[model samples]
Target: MSHLSRTLPIKRAAHVYLVHEGQLLLVEERMDDGSIFYGLPGGKANAGETLGDAAVRQVLVETGLRVTDLMFVSLIEGELLTGTRNECYANFGRFTASFSGDLAPTDPEVVGVKWVPFEQVEGLVRYGPPPEVEERNPLIWVPTRDFVRGQPRAYYPI
Candidate 1:
């Protein structure tokens, strides 16, 4: 394997946009500085784990909710580069699922999990690595919000 190919590996992940009662279920993270951040309840796909399986496992782990009816929504592709290292990040699959169970944060790093109303999403302040060092991964996550809003969808980050 070439050094460049090894270093610039493809990081594949799957994330779920789970909705419940007109609100989107999300995980809340509190930074040490007391600032709060929110994210969809999913993570990196395990080796040999299909994106659908990973999405199910991650949501259960992070939010204590069981989900089903995974529907394909979008494929988020972007390259994250930092210094000499490059990560060809591919959120190759994205899905929406319906969930059951009381909302809670099973992961210690996740402070809280709750249902966020659609109107509140804009101010939620999505984040990514520093745009300069880390090639930006969709500054605005279009798949989640658009899905929740029931809007016509095309992929782009604002």
Candidate 2:
């Protein structure tokens, strides 16, 4: 029997951070009941697709942007309670990418897309939580900030 059968269902997700002039591209999505949330532009990788390709495709689909210059940033393993799949554990690849295109929302996953100055994201995130709330909340992040300040990228489980 395959060892996959004995392990908890594992889901792969990519998060693309589109940075330009110290700002980051973001998606604002609405739930069926009209609640709103914020998130980076990315999604699941298709079968046999590289994480880089998945990030590029997801950015274009979710935010109507063509992404290039992708770089791997961090690998995160955590517990996420996404509504569609409440897996207790998930592994995620976070990437930094450069993109160019008219700002628009193309995929149904996003209701709005925009660029926000990085420094101001904390305030915005405080009010507009990410879609995968338990997974992508800024409150749980420390890697990028720490890395910039020459600190280690060690993440403590919350």
Candidate 3:
């Protein structure tokens, strides 16, 4: 482990890969700089909450969807850097989830909810899994396809 890993705080997040009919569920938000950002329907886990529970709760709040049968697919560990300094370590748990319900965003930060076509996802999502993670685990990040359910979970460090 590097010095930063030993010194920096860790932030644990849970994100879902909710695919239906070749489209993925995405939450659209406006960043501080007024740029639009598209990301998965989940967020950081709350205190004392399991990652799976966080995933379900975040999905419900962000997309009005009830998710179930979560299958763990990947774990991505990376540093959230501020220029040359390491700010915090990000540990993200990625899951493939089964969800039901219509699209409705309840979160105030969420400006919209979209079902992006699989092929268009890569170009649309500005904040995504790190490149190292995506390159090593194409099945998890590839824009045109979904990872197989029950596939062995993979770990990527960035």
Q: What RMSD does each model have against the real structure? A: 4.3, 4.7, 4.9
Top model number, lDDT:
3
The local lDDT score (0 to 100) that residue 139 gets in candidate 1 is 44
Per-residue alpha-carbon lDDT of model 3 for 1-158, expressed as tens digits?
45663667777879888988878888888766677777788888988988999999999999999999999877877765534343567777888888888888799999999988766777774543333322223332432233422233467665
RMSD of 1: 4.3
lDDT of 2 by residue, 1-158 (tens): 12334346555667787777777777888765577666778877787887788888888889888888888777766555534445445556678777788877679768898778877655555333435554345533555444334353534342
TM-score of every model? 0.77, 0.75, 0.79
| Model 3 error, position 94 (Å) | 0.4
Question: Would you list the rank order by TM-score, best first?
Answer: 3, 1, 2
Clashing pairs in 3: none
Who is ahead in TM-score, 2 or 3?
Answer: 3
Best candidate according to TM-score: 3
After superposing candidate 3, which stretches have Cα over 4 Å from the reference? 82-86, 127-153
lDDT of 3 at 82: 32
User: How would you encode candidate 1's per-residue C-alpha lDDT over 73-117 as one tens digit per residue?
Assistant: 877665444343454545456788877887765788888887788
